[model samples]
Target: MAVRLPILLFRMGLGPAFGKRLLLLHHTGRATGLDRRVVLEVVAYEPNAGSWIVASGFGTRSDWYRNLRVEPKTVVQFGNRHHAVTARFLAADDGADIMARYGRRHPRTARRLCAFMKLPSDGSEASFRDAGRAIPFVRLDEARPRLP
Candidate 1:
């Protein structure tokens, strides 16, 4: 119930209030073909690429991660702004780099995230990189319209 609070806020058009740190993901159930929504933390935002990087704290076992693998096309709402996007799984190397940098920027949050994911973190670059390699990171890139 507490986890759904953010989704409710998003539905109330207050999601953007959280800025780029959090987003509401509108996805589909692969097997049920049903619309579903989840709020995820945005680890990194690439302004140039118009993409947001997020990680599955529960690794590949996460249902949202599984659903995204099957249907990458989806919608992401960063507060008031919504975009048509596709989910791209980042490589382990990229994850390592991102995690290392993220730890540098937000040491406490990074450590907390690692703990939540059941990954040990010593607040060191190598530890963060190792944790990254173990987790599943996804990039939600703004999808370009197909030429008709």
Candidate 2:
């Protein structure tokens, strides 16, 4: 499928082609218990905390989103580097804040993301907030190795 093209690229070690804007999420299927992969647009990258925030444009129905909810500990690929991470489901308020910031930083891309999700946005902060409230965001924080 056309949608799986990114996944294939990631598999081929061409993930660097997508740069920092896109990351490959490797999670386990909640029902099937099989490995699954999805490429999601990075809504925000927190360098200080080594976390990557992403939104579920399809809402809670997205398999990857739900998968992470069940198994917070997973791995993600940014370019060719893979890191163990823990998923943190953000609250609606946090989503609103991130969405607002994202809109301000990348207006055109934000509008396109909203449009793709069929959310009406006039490029106003309020509209972005509304869209954020409707969408679910997850922060993937890098997992720290446990000391023995």
Candidate 3:
């Protein structure tokens, strides 16, 4: 089956429980200078740190990630909530640490995430080590609720 089914469910307001937390992200394309909307999973939320973490499973090849790199300021929507924020690309070391912690806390989900990212299984330290290079992390900065 195509992964499109799961992605569709999320877009249609279902299946967020099954590893797809639908996120509506708005960014400006660097080359096109047009607004873009993307759906992504929410990897982690750190209220104390005032940031939310996301992973670019497609690495630098993903368009959304590339757009954010060119223009850090963007808008995000989680469920019914929306916010204006800045995106910060995490270093390889930091991404590894975050992936390690996530793998430890949610092994099964982590493994699934690894598979989705087309990386190796989460049970392998080698895989976790490789995630830094394979899957990069992004931090949402200066997040403020979007006005309805």
TM-score (all chains, Cα) for each model: 0.94, 0.93, 0.75
Over the stretch 22-115, how does candidate 2's per-residue lDDT look in tens digits? 9999999999999999999999997667899999988999999999989999999999999999999999999999999999999999999899
Name the regions of candidate 2 deviating beyond 4 angstroms: 145-148
Please identify model 3 stretches exceeding 4 Å from their true place.
1-20, 116-118, 143-148
Please give the lDDT score at residue 111 for candidate 1: 97
lDDT of 3 by residue, 1-148 (tens): 4655644544576544443344667789889999877667777875555567888878888899999989998877655455678999988888888888877777787788788877777486557767655688998865653333
Looking at model 2, the pairs that clash are none
**Candidate 1 vs candidate 3: which has greater lDDT?**
1
Span of 10 residues, lowest total lDDT, candidate 3: 13-22
Q: Given candidate 2, what's the lDDT at residue 52?
A: 94
Better of 1 and 2 by lDDT: 2
> Per-model C-alpha lDDT, please?
0.91, 0.93, 0.74
Pairs in steric clash, model 1? 15-79, 16-79
Q: What is the lDDT of residue 68 in candidate 2?
A: 90
